[model samples]
Target: MTHNPDFKDGAAYIGGEFVPIGEAKISVLDWGFTRSDAVYDVVHVKDGRFFRLDDHLARFERSMARRRIELAEDRQALKDILVRCVQLAGLTDSYVAMVASRGRPRVKGSRKPSDCANHLVAYAIPWIDVIPLEVQERGAKLLISDHPRVADEAVDPTVKNYQWSDLTSGLFDANDEGFDTAVLCDGRGMVTEGPGFNVFAVIGGGLVTPERGCLHGITRQSVIDICGKEGIVCRAGDLPRADLETAEEVFLCTTAGGIMPIAQVGERVIEAGAPGPVTRRVMASYTAMHEDAAYVTFVDTPTRFAAAE
Candidate 1:
């Protein structure tokens, strides 16, 4: 096992032990690895503070409950592990994730869910932005995916899971078409979401996003809150492909990057294929919130600084 020289690069808590991320391991028999039976959430830390920490934790708990997987650690205990993981990494800005997975089945060939134990895995690594800063500034180009989202009846979209086959295919389609990313639609041609982000559009001078068939992102909620504060007139409802194609502006929201503007959908140009006024406004507002004391959940920095004092 090798520990990376820079602590801020990689650190993880596997099973009941803390280890270098490169050293962390899961058994081949684990359901999470074999069948992709896992639920996880990522929370962003900026300047030693977690943004919307409680909201992320609450959504994670809901995802776990929906999957019928429970870890031995309670909310407070899990939060402590996350904080310690960040401390171990010595990262002022990081991307941290909490995962709960179905473990190896105990009865050898048993197919029952109860035959396995569930476990928690947490990690802290340097911050990541899904849409790079340069890309965001220039704005992203999205391919309206030919592949559709998996029916919500089969797998609830609200529960964060590892069922990404459909999304993966769509992303490949986007790449083949020479686009930045993809946005999926439902069977009826209603826009559902993108691979890792929620879709939003500025239609007829109003902001709208799909009401169903997408993960209820914490950052999406933050955008809505910002809209309410700024009086931007945002709403959630069915957004058709036609509306998206003809919209004045579009953007994606996720924890990795708060708000990313979209300049084109396939061959359609929006706001002259540039980040629009409303999109820029929301992005600015979301960015400013990270530095606001009200939105930050600070990590245990005092303990780390104690030895220095």
Candidate 2:
């Protein structure tokens, strides 16, 4: 059934129907809201084209599966919803997210996961940058959090869920220290990642990032791929706090911000405290690839609201 133009304009999909974002809401009893029993993924759109849509969708599928959340929508259906969400917002650059949640239990008092149904929710809003443009331009200052990241056994970082207590606490610690962001280390004192961003360091003419205790970010994978094509050596393994502090350069990767260079890690300046040469090369290549047809998915060809506009 076709929805009204207003319903599809700057709207959101909730419970399989289109409504304004302000009206989109889930049940208060939903485990997704109560227990963070949900997984989500975001893909950015530029010039009405989605970047790495397929990769993001694949990851979202994996996250949902890991959480044992089953939904009726398939990949194609989800893709259509994403495109529609972006089109509805009439945004050229947007932040698009898809979420799968364990719905409220069928029996109000049931404690079994089996009694709950899974549901999907998604939205597209104006573009978001994990590191704001000004911060990116000036380079970011990072504080090493005394707080450790949540253990992999407790909650898998590989599955992107709403379990952000540790991350948020790190941010608070960073804020108190007058820093732009925070990166948490594991209990073993190995550098993990920052809130909503993956960490990387350039040392001995190669790139090294933590192999564990970090989300396998889509943007991180893009940087690694670009490295292979550009003949820049990049590896993933255990990165200690000392290694990060003494690195020649540091940067962050995220779906929201793309590539962000670091100026300092707790007052230890990186490469004269500016975006380094390798970081610049990667950022330039990443920007140029946005125009590559291979990575862009268009959603405006037959936009439902084009006639009204």
Candidate 3:
């Protein structure tokens, strides 16, 4: 992003203006910044446009409800802000991020109802390719964590938030232990999810994942959609630790990271010791689908909230 002396020297979007991220201003006393009490979403961009835009926005809205935070901007407005940010950054196939927080004043009388926010941030990174090239080349390894994923009833994992202190501990342990990623299970000892992704298994002659507890990752859903078209039987049910160890294939699904195949589970080697056939097919299908997706772009002509202006 071009540096502007007028802004704080960091590239960011504040209210409806583009400024350096550092220059972008918000209240330190704003409950949103002070409290990690916020909800957010990131939309995967393909070919300079967002994929499943509506679906992502719906999740953001639901997350706001879950956090008891009102959306600072509505659906159409959010899209406009994202497009402007992406255009400014010159990103193609990037991620559009949004965060909404509780509108509270840091000081008692500084309160402003307009301080509620659906703050925006944007960046582009290479396709996460599900499996890292290094891991895929050497065969992926996992260090199962004793870390417990929060139960859906206690706190829904689907609500994307900043409270990642739990996952960070597991990731640190996994890093020291020389593992690619960390895994977590629900209160029932059933595999709930990974630190930032969804888990899948090839068992009972069908593909399976834990139902509803983990983030309803759009990536996982797309893979399931491909399975039907490609004649791969699929299932969603409880996934126990032993079930994964004994399964024919294991992998993870996420938006930024697509389909990551699990080659080594703990010290035991999985079958074939590489990306499995099902994961491969799904990955290829997803790539083709997005590369040829229909995009909705924001027209260059400006749209105005005439009353506010």
Candidate 4:
């Protein structure tokens, strides 16, 4: 397939065909659109290779299973589609997303979720940073938002769904207050996560992140692995807002931005407004892993396509 100039910015897959990202569309009635009944996952392609492709796909599958959304494409088909999107977009570094949406109910006006068909929609666009590069350089300023995260019971945090009212509201609050981003708590005063990233804190010489009320982010796992390999103590459990406030260092992790150090949380400054020693070490390790064969899937390799076939 020849590359289209319209797709130079982005490309998408929908209904078994590829199109320019702008041309991609879904029915307004699709539950995924109207009711936000969808589960999605993102995997970054850097330097023409996909980072932790298998892990991202596995998580995507798990999310779909949890939401009871099934599409006709299997794992291999999904991978091929995602690769094609990046190829069509001609992007060396791209942010790729695979989504499973609960389509409009076959029987009009049916409220039953089981009556709706499910399908996959995917796209690849330019690489994105949840926190801009310049902000990451000096470290981000965050707000402890007043809006609390939706309880895990109401909407499973483990499943990557489109339920973001609380997160978006918090982000608005942060921006309005002149902060770069925001993190929501569990109402009980336990820190949860930011809009698109997981929170981490270094306190008393150990690393701790909230074990609940947050998405189990791939980058968060990478940080945990890096800590283990580097012999730094890391644990996941209740991370109270007060404890986070007193942390010697703080950071956020996500697929889009990797490891981002925090310079300040609310009015308190961390590590004198800079990326701390441990945060810098982990960031370096995360960057290095992008080149590791064990963690990457090259995008242009015909062998990968053949294997998927």
Which candidate has the top score in TM-score? 4
| C-alpha lDDT score of every prediction, in listed order | 0.87, 0.88, 0.69, 0.91
Model 4 clashing residue pairs (backbone): none
**Candidate 2 C-alpha lDDT tens digits along 144-203:** 899999998888999998899999999999899999999999999999888999998999
Candidate 1 lDDT tens digits, 27-137? 999999999999999999988999988888999999999999989988877777788788888888899999999998989998888898899999999889987889888
Which digits, one per residue and each the tens of the lDDT, describe model 3 over residues 41-113?
7777666657777777888889877766765577888766665555555556565667676645534665554
What are the TM-scores, per candidate, against the unseen true structure? 0.94, 0.95, 0.83, 0.96
**How big is the positional error of residue 19 in model 3, measured in Å on the Cα after superposition?**
2.2
Best-fitting candidate, measured by lDDT?
A: 4
Q: What is the lDDT of residue 146 in candidate 3?
A: 82
Comparing candidate 1 with candidate 3, which one achieves the higher TM-score? 1
Off by over 4 Å in 2: 1-10, 301-309
Residue pairs with backbone overlap in model 1: none
In terms of TM-score, how similar is model 2 to the real structure? 0.95
